[model samples]
Target: MSEFADQYLCAFRQTPAETELHQAAKRYVSEAEAYDRTVCTGPISKDGILPATPRELALVNRNAHALLTRIADAHSHLFSRGELLREISRVDRLGAPA
Candidate 1:
């Protein structure tokens, strides 16, 4: 596993009880780590790239995006509107994302 994945495991300490959440978090971290690796490693097209099959990629992207938004919304007090706006701008810069 990647260091980021390991870090997540360490921080989250997943158990068999929350199997679904644990699996979802694992996928999100794994995908994020793959994205980071692809970007940082060299000249590679980050778009149209994914960890598993195209369908899996779509699922990962959809679920991860939804979970991230929920996390941000739930912890809105932890972030300012300006910061959130900047984040949205960053995502926009990435591409025409939803």
Candidate 2:
């Protein structure tokens, strides 16, 4: 697994949340993995770019947005801005953008 995946799994293990946030994170990870597999298997264009199909793009975007919103909603009220930034930094160290 990649560092990001390792970090995500670790986060899930370490943090406690309501069902919705947990599920959202799980879905985000699932969609990300799917995107990774798609990129690995997707066809390259004539110009050499690996363009995603509209459906694939939509799925990834939707899941990513949902995950971010869920994370924010789950933590925003509980954590101060500095605390949130620290958490975000930790997650960013996973080497993936949110």
TM-score of every model versus the real structure:
0.33, 0.37
List where candidate 2 sits over 4 angstroms from the true fold.
Answer: 1-51, 80-90, 93-98
lDDT of 1 by residue, 1-94 (tens): 9998877665555344334333333444445556545434333354434444555556656665775666446545555434544554454345
lDDT of 2: 0.51
Q: In candidate 1, which residue ranges exceed 4 Å CA deviation?
A: 1-50, 81-98
lDDT (Cα, tens digit) per residue for candidate 2, span 1-98: 99988877653343453333344444445555556455543565432223367766676566656665666666665544344444444443453333
- Count of residue pairs whose backbone atoms collide, per candidate: 0, 0
Task: State each model's C-alpha RMSD to the native.
Answer: 14.8, 12.3
Predicted structure 1: clash tally? 0
* Error in Å for residue 40 of model 1: 21
